[model samples]
Target: MATMPRLLFLVPVLVGLAAPPALAQSEPFRVVNRTTAPALALHAVRSGRGDWGGNLLNRGPLAPGAFFALRPSEGAGCSFDLRLVLQDGQEIVRRNTDICTDRTVVMTLSGAARPVVPAPDGKPTPLPAPAAATARPGVAPGARPNPQARASTGTGFVVGPDQVLTNHHVVEGCSRIFVRAADGRTLPVPQAPASDARRDLALVRAPGNPGPALAFRANPVRRGESVVTYGFPLAGLLSSGPTLTTGEVSALSGLADNQTQFQISAPVQQGNSGGPLLDRQGNVVGVIVSKLNAARIAQRTGDIPQNVNFAVKGTEALDFLRRNGVQPVLRESPGEERSAAEVGEQVHPSTVFIRCER
Candidate 1:
């Protein structure tokens, strides 16, 4: 039987006007295809605010290293969101750039080449270079030391321009916390006054100057609903940033005690502590704290217990930040955000597989 090839999606945001004057010249952009299989077909859709318009389809297959040119439709002051859907129903959605005047934008589509593996002969083999490694700073020849190589894995996100939200256990006794952004920028977490220890949360100022603006969600989530979790699991084995995992709400209330925390069915591993749990719409729902271990409970109670996990509620985190005058931009979902497959190909480097050093 022939195995089906995986479909890839690329959501490229093109900003500019759709008028004749704007279409006269085009700006250049790049689209990288990060999949093992060749793209059988490519399609693009234009949308704005809440309206989705017509779609442009590419009939031919976009082989590895192929690039496509996107042209704007004729219209003045019309803003659009570009969505790319692959043959297998995967999508990449991005907000279109605003049109200042009539101008054209050019974009290039780059494909991910398949990796080369050697046969079982115990011989060294070569592999294709990965799509650019998320932007990393250059190290001098024979540099004395690299802090990140010896950093600890912890769950954290920007709460302010340079501030981060995480658990005290994550950075507990470490002399310093090494923070990395989704874009592959390395940063340092400066010591900040710890919050109420009962909550197990703390604030740390992210180094490297200013980073992405902090965002928080105010909507409440219910049980059995879909949710996504992000964090760095098995540190050192993986790079640091937002790692995405999907699961459903197992329980809304707490299992241990009211002071414990809410529980989610999401499967989180070691090094994932203190990561954010987001809703299907990409809103923060809670912060992953720990997984419910039946074995541990069984050992304590002399009986096997059910497995469960705990998370710090988003509402609680929001309240703490607000009362402390953190003032994060709290916003409700615009409607239904794009699905995982529709969002765009996620770069795995954005996620770091974490492992402890014994």
Candidate 2:
């Protein structure tokens, strides 16, 4: 019997962080297909804003190893999210990504290509394939894969048993959403409570029992205090578990002096949205939201800034939960600090992987 060709979803590891070329700045951003397989459709959108801008490659398929430029609307900023559907029906998505920073994104596909065939009705019919297969192959037959595939990923943490807190943008427009615990158990989330889109926070109930709920910090966050973030960035594609990065509270206000957020120096990636921003004592201070656009900033001031990321202030989340009639556990900041490793262990159980499907 002939084995089926393994479908590959090749997304650039750091395409979101790619620095746009300054000298040859053309359209704000564009995509280059470096993969061997044809991209059936491509869609781009401004992060945290509107719908998938529509197919940039027109109504036709993008040939293998071809590229095209994106024409975003007038107000579409440098930060964008992308979705590319392959000929095999497998989709590769990068969310809340900064494409304007990098003028060109050269996408690549791995493994063999399965050509989509035209049906008897004259419509193109893509070959049936696994939507997402990020887990490592081989093991006992029918054994659960370590890291399962997801349509799109975001970061969320346990606030109450069967209750998770995340950005509304993370789960917005999701027909189906699920939460994957640090232990690798996938829990379905059918619906979300009323969300505060202005503040970008939402709370959803988990279908299964969850780990220890994370505690929030009551007092205000100060500038220059050490902080850390934990979440699943790139999920099965990068690491099989949650990732951690450390930094300090760069500022008390968000972009444009927004009082509902904070500026941090910790590095954040596409999947880091909605993850917990914990202080040194492991208390939740904020939710990872977004980062600055290096390309846009460079266009404004002939210099490229680094490590300027933003998070929704924990107090905002508190108010939203209170409005929803759910009282979250709150704790005062600890006088003494714990080691980074200790903090990670204490909070890792409560951190979870959030997936959205439509």
Candidate 3:
């Protein structure tokens, strides 16, 4: 049987796009889905890469009438090849497109002419743009007020006697934020957090001390290395204390080969963000960031990828803290291996429950 063509390359695409009438000003750049069918998969790679990185659409397919921004790391290279898979299982390939220079890259199923808008001045807006219809990287379009005062929770860990580290998105628009220690005492986050939204990191101080801060590993993490994570997942719905889960380092890079993050096999959940990913010796290696949206991935691939989760590398977190004038307590991993229980007990005090109320 003849093999089906999975990809269809559109070569020599004329480089011009006209701003559509429905385009919002705050969404400075976007991938307008002008096609009638859903855009099933999206992939991008540097100009010369042999293969594309992880599918950028893992969050969910870009359905008809929707669009996505091309978010790259700060100062990353501009030239990239974009691959868009359509519902009919046909792929659209655009070669060496300069996302760094364009305001928006639109996807279409129809061959009808699209008005080429003038290129916006300067570099392209970053990908995976915030769900909010805004121009900022991580800021969502608008805050939906929780009038009923609903409670949402996530995880964090201590970096110093007073400073706790967590994901900025976890506490983005909170009217009040608090940290709960293992002892069940709730401490207030006295002031606003110092955050790096692009990196999704936040540094906030607790009134009193939580406990001995967890230490960062001095060396880089390797693939297949055993690791562990602790967090208060599904808080108020699960046990009151922190939960520990263990796995091995599946990959050195994260989704789309992001070097600043790790692809871990360790299981994580909504409440696991900002929790620590530790080595066998109880040294911090990374911070649990997110897990693949398995349901969505399965919808596209027809098979679920097992145990694919991600974490921010410790190096990135360390740099963020230092830039903010907070030096983390760094330590080297001991040669000795500790049991999961022992490591859990040693790090438990540093793990904290982060609560946000609007």
Output the lDDT of residue 210, model 1: 30
What Cα-based lDDT does every candidate model obtain? Answer: 0.49, 0.70, 0.69
Tens-digit per-residue lDDT, 1-358, candidate 2: 1111211121111122211222321244556666656787776655554556446655577776666665554435445667677765555555555443456665655432334576799645557544332222222322332333225678888888788988766775454567788888877664544566678787878757767889999888889999999987775568868889999999999887989989999988778888999998999999998778766677768898889888989988888888877788999996798887888998999998877653
Q: Of models 1 and 3, which has the larger TM-score?
A: 3
Every model's TM-score: 0.51, 0.62, 0.61
Ranked candidates, highest lDDT first: 2, 3, 1
So what's the TM-score on candidate 1? 0.51
How far residue 92's Cα lies from its native spot in candidate 3, in Å, is 33
lDDT of 1 by residue, 236-278 (tens): 4554444566777777776545444677776676667767776
Report the Cα lDDT for residue 92, model 2. Answer: 59
lDDT of 3 by residue, 1-358 (tens): 1111122222221111111112222222456667777876777665546777666676667787777765454323344667677665445555544453455676654432222222377312233322321111221222332435544577889998788999875765455677878777778776677877667788877767876788999977779989999997766566777889999999889877888888889887668888889999999988888788676567657898788888889999999999888888888886777888888988998888887663
Off by over 4 Å in 3: 1-148
Candidate 1's C-alpha lDDT?
0.49
Model 2 pairs in collision: 20-101, 20-102, 20-103
Which sequence of candidate numbers ranks them by TM-score, best first? Answer: 2, 3, 1
Worst 10 residues of 2 by lDDT: 1-10
